[model samples]
Target: MSTIVFLHAHPDDEASQTAGTMRLAADAGHRVVCVYATNGDHGTLPTDLAEEETIVLRRRAEAEASGQVLGTARVAWLDYADSGMTGWDQNGHEESFHAADLDEAAGRLAAILDEEDADVVVGYDWHGGYGHPDHVKVHHVARRAVELAARRPRYLEATMNRDHLRRIFRAGVEAGLFPEDEGFDPDRPADDGNPIGTPEAELHWHVDVRPVLASKRAALACHASQEDVGWMLGMPEDQYAMAFGDEWLSEPGRPEGIEDGLPF
Candidate 1:
C-alpha cells in the first residue's frame, strides 16, 4: 500500500484541512502518517486543564487523539513552539517554528519522510490557507524537506479554493447565518497580507470528501481543547458539509485545471 505523509503547521491543522483526505487514504488501505511542525503552545487556553498540565502537553494529546480519529498510523511533532498569528509577540519566541532555522526544520521533516518512505507528502499552499506564520513556514519546510529527503515523494500542496469559500460566505450572509457586518471578507488581507487561499483557476485537484465528512468532523472534535473546534462542531450538518465537503490541492509547477478526486 502507498504511504501518505501529511505535513501540518500545528496539531489541529490536520483536522481542519486534511482530515477527510487522511480518512479516505486510510480507508483505502494506505498508510497515513501526520507530522506537525509546532506544539501549538499559543492556541486558546483550555479551561479544564489539570493543575500541572501545560497547553503544549494538552495540544499534543489532542493531536494524538485527532490522529486516532482519522486512522492515522502515527503522529509526529517537530517540537517547535507555536508562533501566534502574524504580529503577536509570541512570534519573537526563539524556539517558535517561525523563528527556527529553515534548513534545520526541513532536515527534521526530511528525517521523518525518509523513515516513513513516504510515497506522497501533502503540505500547505504557498499562502498556507490563512497565512499564519507557522503555516507559511510549513509551506517552505515541506518543499525543502522533499528535496532533502532520500525518498522523492510526490508532493501535493493542500489548500482551500478561495472562490469556493467566498461563495459560501456570501451565501451564509444572505441566509442570516452570518451577519453582513461580520467583517470576515475572504477578499480581505489575511495574517500574511494576502487572501486566504489560491484561486480556483490555479488549483489542480478537487477532492470530494463528503463521503468521509463524518470522520473529518469527528477528527476536529478530538481537538476539543480548542475553542474553535466547538464552533465548528456546532454548525448545522448541512452547513458544515457545505463549508468543508471538499478539499483542494495544487501540485508544484502543474498548470493543469482541477481534476476530480485524489490523484495519488
Candidate 2:
C-alpha cells in the first residue's frame, strides 16, 4: 500500500480541506497519516472562562473523531503554538510558529517522513491555502521534510486556481451563499496582506472529488470551532457539493498535461 502523509497547519485543516481525499485514499487500501502542525489553541473559545482548556480538548477530540471517520492510519502533531495571521501581533512573537526556527521545524517534520516512509507528502500551497503564517510554515516544513527524507516522497500542496476560485465565489454569491460584494480576489500576492490568491501555475495539481462531497462536509463540520455553522447550514446540498468537488495540489513536477482543472 502506498503511504500518504498529509501535513496540516492546525487541527481542523485536514477536515476542512482534504478529509474526503484521505478517506478515499484510505478506503482504497492506501496508508494515510495526518500531521497537524499546531495545537490550534488560538481558535474560537467558548464564552465560559472556566472551560477554556476544555474547548481545546474538545477540538482535539473532534479531530480524532474526524480522523477515525476518514480511516486515517495515524494522527500526529507538531505541537507548535498557533500563529494566527499577518496582522495579529502575536504572530510576530518569538514563540509563534512564524518566528520559529525553520531548520528545527524541518527536522521535526523530517523525522515523521523518515519514520513513515511516505510515498506522498501533502501540505498547504505557498499561500498556505489562505495566507495564514502557520499554514505557510506547515507548507515549508512539509517540503523540507520531503527534502531531508532519503526516500524522496512526492509532494502535494493544497491550492486553488484564480479562475476556478472566481467561479466558485461567483456561484456562491449567485446562490446567496456568501456576500456578493465581499470583493473576493484570488489573484493577490501572499505578501500583500490578502488571504486568498492564485497559486503558482507550475505547482498546481487538480483532483475532482465530487463523489466524496458529503463526506467532506461531514468532516468539515467536525471543525465547528473554525467553520461557520450558519453558513454551511444555509447552503443547499447541491451547491455545497459543487463547492467542495474541486481540490488543488501545490508543488512542482506534477504529471505533465494532466488537465488544468479537477479530474474525477
Candidate 3:
C-alpha cells in the first residue's frame, strides 16, 4: 500500500480540507499521515482552555484528536508559530511560519517525505485557498519539499472549486436556505487579496468524498476549541455535504481531470 502525506497550515485546516481524503486513503489500506506547518499559537482564544494549557497546547491536542477521527496513522507538527492573518504583526515574527526560512522549512518536510517513502503528498493551492499567510507559505514549502525529497512523490495542491461554491451559494440563496445578501462570495478578494480558489478549467482532479463525509464532520468536531467550527458544524447536513462532499486537487501542468478516485 502507498503512503499519502497531507501538509496543512494549521490544526483544524486538515479537518476542513482533507479529512475525507485522509479517511478514504486509510480505508483503502494506504498509510495516511498529517503534518501541520504550525501549532496555531495565534488562533482564536479558547474560552475553555485550562489554566495550565495554552492555545498552542490546546490546538495541538485538538489536531491529534482530529487525526485519530480521520484514521490518520501519524500526525506531525513542524513546530512553527502561527503567522496570524495576512497583515497581522505576528507575520513578521522570526518563529512564525510566514517568516520561516524557506529552505529550512522545506528541508524539514523533505525529511518526512524521505522517511515515509511517500507515494503522494498534498498541499494547499497557490494562494492557499483563501490567502492566509501560513497557508500561502504551505504551498511554497510543500512544493519545495517535494522537490527536495529523495522519494519524489506525486504532488497535488488541494483547493476549493470556486465555480462550484458560487453555484451552491446561488442555489442556496434561491431556496432561501442562505440569506441572499449574507451568503459567501467566492469571487471576492480574500485574506491576501486573491479570490478564493481556482476556476474549474484549471483543476485536475475532483475526488468524490461523500462516502467519508461523516468521518470528515467528526474530525472537524474534534476541534471544539475553535469557535468558527461551531457555525460550520451547525450548517444544514445537505448543505454541508453539498459544499464539502467533493475535494478538488490540481496537478501543475496536468490537463486531464478525474472525478472519482486519486491515481494511487
Model 3 agreement with the true structure over 111-221: per-residue lDDT tens digits: 999999998999989999999999999999999999999979999999999998899889888876788879489999999888899998888887888999999999999
Positional deviation of residue 156's Cα in model 2 after best superposition, in angstroms: 1.6
lDDT of 2 by residue, 48-160 (tens): 43534566676777788778878889988777778887779878777678888988887878888889987888877776766778887887888888888878888877766
**Model 2 vs truth, CA RMSD:** 3.0
For every model in order, what is the number of clashing pairs? 0, 1, 0
- The root-mean-square deviation over C-alpha atoms between each candidate and the true structure, in angstroms, is 1.4, 3.0, 1.2
The C-alpha lDDT values of all candidates are 0.90, 0.74, 0.90
Off by over 4 Å in 3: none
Q: TM-score of every model?
A: 0.96, 0.86, 0.97
Residue 116 shift from truth in candidate 2, angstroms: 1.2
* lDDT, candidate 1, 139-239, per-residue tens: 99999999999979999999989899889888988887766787877778988899889899989998899999999998998898898888889989878
